[model samples]
Target: MNGSQALSITDRKADEQAMIAAHNCAVARSFHSYFNQYILTDHERGYIVIDEGDYGALPQHLMDRVVDAVPSKMIDEH
Candidate 1:
């Protein structure tokens, strides 16, 4: 890769790492319980997951906020 392309990849990786850290910190402070927070991205799609196990385990307000933040197409049906 060219120098510019290499730099771009480095910058993107740094940005993604920052995003992951921020999301994990937010989930920890906001949820007040154990949960897995993931920010996944690929060629086709990107999405965030705040999994608190079963669907019923997730708070409605938090779920609503998550849904509102993410695009419908990014969310997996099942």
Candidate 2:
């Protein structure tokens, strides 16, 4: 999504759900982070699609990543 159309997290460092998207630990950037951000909308509930997380995939793989998160500011509604 473009910057203007993209969602905003007022508190980038908020404690709701924090999965670092970048680091120097040599992790691949090919994976996606905060997927719930795409599924969540204002005044809506957001959750992980697969509770088990990354079925059949090896741990730490890109498909293995699942984040049940919305913007930090939106977390208060829950």
**TM-score to native of every candidate shown:** 0.33, 0.17
**lDDT of each residue in 1-78, candidate 2, tens digit only:** 766673457544432332343221112311333222311112232222331223343245433344333322222233
Model 1 residue 29 lDDT score: 42
Q: Point to the candidate with the largest TM-score.
A: 1
Clashes of 2: 0
lDDT of 1 at 36: 42
Which lDDT tens digits does candidate 1 get at residues 1-78? Answer: 765555478777876776666565545544443434433333333334554433545565555545312212223335
Question: Candidate 2 — which residues are off by over 4 angstroms?
Answer: 5-45, 58-65, 68-78
| Model 1 segments more than 4 A misplaced | 1-7, 33-78
